[model samples]
Target: MKSNIIRSVLSATALGVLSSSAMAHGDEEHAKPRTFDASKVEATAFGQEGNPKKVSRVIHVGMSDHMRFSPATISVKRGETVKLVVRNDGQILHEMVLGTKEALKEHAELMKKFPEMEHADSNMAHVKPGKAGEIIWQFTKAGEFEFACLQPGHFEAGMVGKVLVK
Candidate 1:
C-alpha cells in the first residue's frame, strides 16, 4: 500500500511537470515572428495604381461635405499584407481607422463621448484635405473588419467600408 501511494504521487508530479513544459513550449512558438503572404492580398477597390503591386494598392477615398468614401468595399485574404493609400479630398480633417467590426463599434461609441479618441497606432491614419497618408496592415485572421472615418458623424453618413478578410 505504501509503495502504491508513492508511485501515484510520483506519477502526478510527473504529469504536472509535463503539462508546465508543454505550456512553455507553446508560449515559445507563439513568440516566433509571423509572416503574411503578399499574393493573397486582393485589391477589391483602388483609385489609380501607378503599379498595382510595386506602387502599392492605392485606395483613393474622398471625404467631402459631412461624410463620403469612394469604393467602400474591399476584400483581402487572411494573413496578407496591404498598403492602403488614403487621400483626403474634402475640406475637413479626416481619418481612416482599420479594425475589427467589434473594435470599430466600440471605438465609435468612445468617439461619440470623446471626439478626440483617434487611434494613432498602425491601425489608423489621419490625413488632411488634399493630403495623402498610408496604412500598412496585415490581416492576421479571417473576418469582417471596418474601415471608417471616425470624424464625429462621418460613419453614420456613409463614410464606412467593409474589409472582408478571408
Candidate 2:
C-alpha cells in the first residue's frame, strides 16, 4: 500500500509540473507585449520609441555563456538616436532590456513570474544562441540607466550593464 501511495504522489507531482509548463508556454498572454507606461517609467531613461532609419550611430555588444555582457558600459549623448547591435555569443538565450535600476528589477521580477512572456519594444532586444538583434533608441534624457537580460537566471547571474547618457 505504501508503494502504491508513493507512486500516486509521484504521478501527481509530474502532472502538476507538466500542467504548469504548458500553462506558462501555451498561454497566448505570454506572448503578448508588456507595454510600458511612458509617464511612470523613469525620467532619465530612454523611452521605447525610435525609428531605426534615423539612428545616429550603432554600438556593438556581445553576450557570452559566462553570463556577462562585453563592453558592459556604454555612453551616449542626450537626444542621440543610437542602435544597439547586440549579439548572443552564448550557448543559451539572452536579452537586452533598457530601463532604470528600479524599473529593471521590477521587470525582471515579472519575467521570473512569467518566463514565457515576450514583448516587441524599441528599447529591448532578444537574441537566441549564436544570434544577433538590434535596439534603436533615442536617448531623450541625460542620466545613468541599466540594461539587463531578465531571462530567468540570467539577471541573477549578473547579466547587466550600465548606460551613461550625457
Give the candidate number with the greatest lDDT.
Answer: 2
Tens digits of per-residue lDDT for model 2, 16-37? 6545634432223222333434
| Residue-wise C-alpha lDDT for candidate 1, range 51-103, written one tens digit per residue | 23443344565556557666678887675667787887877777787765655
| Strongest candidate by TM-score | 2
TM-score of each: 0.61, 0.73
**Candidate 2 overall lDDT versus native:** 0.73
Q: Give the clashing pairs for model 2.
A: none
lDDT of model 1 at position 90:
79
In model 1, what are the clashing residue pairs, if there are any? none
C-alpha RMSD (angstroms) for model 2: 11.6
